[model samples]
Target: MDGYTTALVCAAAAAGAALVRSGKRYIDNSAVELLAAPDGVRAMIEAHCPSLVAPARARLVPPPYLPTGMLQTIYGAMVALRRDSESDIEYDRQLRTMEDGGTVSLDWFPARPSGPECAQPIAIVMSGLGGSAYEYHIRCLAKHLATKSRAGMRVAVLNYRGSGRTPLTSSTMYNGYDTSDIYDTVGYLAQSFPRAPLVCVGFSMGANLLARYLGETGDKSRIAACVTVSCPFSGETAGRAINAPGLLFDKFFQPALTGTIKRIVKRNQDIIQSGAITYDIDAIMRAKRVCDVDNALTARAYGFKDCWEYYAACSSTDFIERIRCPFLAINALDDPIALPEGLPMDQIAKNPRAAIALVAHGGHIGFFSGLSARMWHLQPVLEFLDAVLADKAE
Candidate 1:
């Protein structure tokens, strides 16, 4: 079959599989509940997904509108195909040099209503694995925040070491647990806008980095609030889930990761020939699974013994309780990559400052809700950040 025909067949197969497995149960919402919020805000959320709220706490009686688990998961990936590239959203690119001599790219989109003269709050967005400011979800959220004139929130996205157009200066690539880059980026932002409140919004792997950084820094962290969307709390479990049979998460991720690794190797081929860096370029290029890519490329680059060790060390679940800042974790029960089962819900419940919104439908970072593929999690996130900032002010 031709490439277009192959893509069509794959999409059809995914839709067929979703339909066949429509009734297959996934999330058990009996114990799962929304984070404690004011009755009014709780009512708003419950109006959309009643399953998210406890039966006794729900004020609105709207029927839950969550799509089937399989549909949610499939649409999460499918929406990417239909998404428009937000190329028109302007940004001022800045290269923040890291301590390790490497550099990360930061794209700053100033708020439409507030310019440099105003002390506007900055939202530092960390994109998912191999994602840049150009990715659909990242750009969508950035654009949404930009259009919110009253919010006075500037969007700055941190493109990890090797991703985007940023060249990989160092031999090491970013791992899930590493937060040094974020720390430096936040520090830079703080210096640039000393009075501006720093609110971090991280998606997927970026979420893991933010969570780990918060836990590691505690009260010492400069940021005012944090929101982790679709973070894989337990990397070990998430890795296993992505590798599961018939799941398309690995298929979607592996190619991009492999391509990045290939480019990195090619860029540093001179060092490899000189025996300065030891990387099995052939094995890395041949990697088929996410696990293999992590083991051969990520683990080796980051000084981890193996992929399992890397996953265990990088897992944010271990650091959840250590987080003392006001934090919100939003995870979809149907997320195919970040399995809901791996979330540290118990830890979150114990921390008074930490809250969780366990939505029944958003798959990974895919929370497309309407005909135009509007992100379902955007408003809730904005509301949560507003609440956090208001509490801080008071």
Candidate 2:
């Protein structure tokens, strides 16, 4: 009834909120299961992710004394922010010419040329939604591949059309499920370095595209292996998760989408004026939800009937079973964008060449651990790649 009592009540409420947000169950190693695989791939899975093997439970221990799940996710982002600016890795930038009268930027970090001709495999890295080649995760992976002593591989990060200062010569922009750009990029890489084994690594939306591409091409794919981290298996679930009330995902994404739409609109002003396509630029820019943006801009540009249609066509859930290559798909239980419900766990469990790693708490792409904030997922990824390459050699 008095000021002191009111203040006390408010403090108690805040404490309760904190406790609720911080509370997350640790995943026991016994609960994790490796997807079904054939003899050789199964052996590789056991070697790399033993936790997935039956009776060999492996636990994902969060940093000692730190908050779990959501808190860890936020903390990892903060750590990445601090370290992302200090990257010194240089890239040779090139404009990859596309068949559709468009171009996308590629940042190439080649391995030491003097070592051996095509001795190292080439990794094509794809960035998350609204992400560029210089994104922290992309840069980290590129640097890791380039600097690893045993597997010093060349890295190429693809910047989606109209992203990262890449001009949009055509009116069309990339959507979540589009695989045309990836197809073109891989074609170019295969032709340019005929002797090098190619590997594809994608994060978030890039992962979605990569998964779809793998399923579409199946045994015809030229790449030796593929890895998808934080893929949104179901576009509907991913859209709902990002747009959920009180979450920061939409807040973080909307501004970037607005800017990208604006850039595309400005670049293709002549096309708009000539009535070649219809897009409510103002509505697209003002979109508060990711689905709305996709409907207004992405779907229209790509000729989808609507956002829902676009999401369905782009969702990997429909095609994950068709994936025929050595593949590793990783998703965190607490990832805000890629909800657990979106993953086709049962389907993956049945696929011999595909394995899914469902961690207890690696929020989206924020898989930070220990004092140095190193990405913990990279170890398994590198290990898996090594196993795949070794299997190929045999």
Q: What TM-score, computed on C-alpha atoms, does each candidate reach? A: 0.79, 0.83
Which residue ranges in model 1 land beyond 4 Å of their true spot? 1-32, 36-88, 111-118, 247-251, 271-277
Question: Can you tell me which runs of candidate 2 are displaced by over 4 Å?
Answer: 1-33, 38-40, 48-59, 64-69, 72-87, 111-119, 247-250, 256-275
lDDT of 2: 0.73
Tell how far residue 326 is off in model 2, in angstroms. 0.6
Highest lDDT: which candidate?
2
lDDT for model 1, on a 0 to 1 scale? 0.71
Q: For residues 172-285, write the lDDT of model 1, one tens digit per residue.
A: 676686788888888877876777888989998899989999998887988887889999999898878776656444555556556666776677655433534477777877
Clashing residue pairs for model 1: none
Best by TM-score: 2
Task: Kindly list the per-residue Cα lDDT of model 2 for residues 1-394, writing each as its tens digit.
Answer: 8999999999999999877665434334214445555653666788755544545344455565433556665664454434453345778888877886777988888532333256578888897877777666777777776676255578888888878678776666766867999989889777777777889899988999998898899888998988898899899888777666664554555555556566666676665445467778778667777777787877887688888888777788877788888889877787877888889988786778888877776777876655555666676677677678777767
What's the lDDT for all of these models? 0.71, 0.73
